[model samples]
Target chain A: MLILNVILVIFLIICAVAVERTKDLLGAVIIFAAYSLIMAVLWLMLQAPDIALTEAAIGAGVTTILFIGVISRTRRMEK
Target chain B: MDDIIVKTITRLIVPFIQVYGIFVILHGHISPGGGFSGGAVLGSSMILFTLSFGLPMASRKIPHKVTSILETSGILWYIIIGLAGIYLGGKFLVNKEAGFFMGQAGELISAGIIPLLTLGIGIKVASTMITLFHTIIEED
Candidate 1:
């Protein structure tokens, strides 16, 4: 279990890096979704079912939707 | 000296930031964190995503009306669950006297209404937070 947690943490760090490296805004959005998915898994391992489900549904599901929506309306016209 | 380095760093890590947000949220019950902490993290994740994706793509995924429903539903669910405790045996949100196994420590159903209450709160907090975040950045 300890080792698993360590691996998970390390992987999460890597994902963080991936999120930062992406240039295209749309690509970054997809990577962010991956991050939310991992976090939901971590929550389940931490004995937080309520949190896990919420994260999965809202964090991954609704949140991703919202981000995409906002981005479409007001793009980075400056660039 | 600092601005270039900061932007470079943020660019590299921004894509995966939402994962960290979930990490904070899922680990809420045991540690000093929970739904609120996690929810905020999730909100930030979405904000950052919007910052990158632009409003058109963002709006295509999450419209304002959906967020409104999510926010209100969460509030209503929390209220209804809390009221259940009042009608059961104790005051509003008094879980121990509500309904559950009410026997043996560490039993699956022992905590009575606590689990249900937590579930409601978790949903309320998570959806509401997401809704608020969406509202702020949503396409008009």
Candidate 2:
């Protein structure tokens, strides 16, 4: 479990950097959603089911929708 | 999307998603979930519908005026429940001692006022999500 936690944490860091370094807005938004999903999974592994559920729903779910809407309404590629 | 597969799958699975959301809200007091999480699940389904079908179709199901009313009503409902406790000679939001039906624990209708509060919160949260999405997507 500790190894799994370490792996997830490392993956989360990678996701965070990838989200930042990406030039495409849509790609960044998608990576952010993946980051939210991974954080939710981490919460589940920590035995915080309630928080895990909230994070998955709000972070990965509605926030993703909002980001998609923003991306569609505005420019998709960053200069 | 114009894609046939996305539309068909969204139509097929939306009902099941809603049912699951309702279950989560209803079973909140007896299980690990509560108003926030359950409401998020319900909100996400509506959001999913909007994603697949577009905002106009989704607006008919939950319009702007109705969403606003429901959101305010949810908060009002919560306060009203708390006031009931005060009216019954207890502190605000008091449960079980305010003459509420305290059925056997771990049952559906057991917790006094908790389920009611959860219902209010669920409605509020769901409507808020829809409203926020609509606001962002609506053209000026």
Q: Quick one: best lDDT, which candidate? A: 2
DockQ, model 2, C-alpha based: 0.85
> How far does residue B72 in candidate 2 sit from its true spot (Å)?
1.3
Give per-residue CA lDDT, model 1, range B26-46, as digits (tens): 444344455565555555555
Q: How close is chain A of candidate 2 to the true chain A, as a TM-score?
A: 0.94
User: DockQ numbers for every candidate?
Assistant: 0.05, 0.85
lDDT for each residue of candidate 2 in B1-140, tens digit (9 for 90 to 100): 67789999999998998888888889889887788898888888888888889888888988899999999999999999999999985799988678899899999988899999999999999899888988998878
lDDT of each: 0.64, 0.91
Tens digit of lDDT per residue, candidate 2, span A1-79?
A: 8999999999999999999999999999999999999999999999999899999999998998898888898899999
The alpha-carbon deviation from the true structure for residue A40 of candidate 1, after best TM-score superposition, in angstroms, is 23
TM-score of chain A of each: 0.81, 0.94
TM-score, structure 1 vs. true: 0.47
How large a fraction of the reference contact set does each model reproduce?
Answer: 0.00, 0.88
Off by over 4 Å in 2: none
Evaluated at residue B84, the lDDT of candidate 2 is: 95
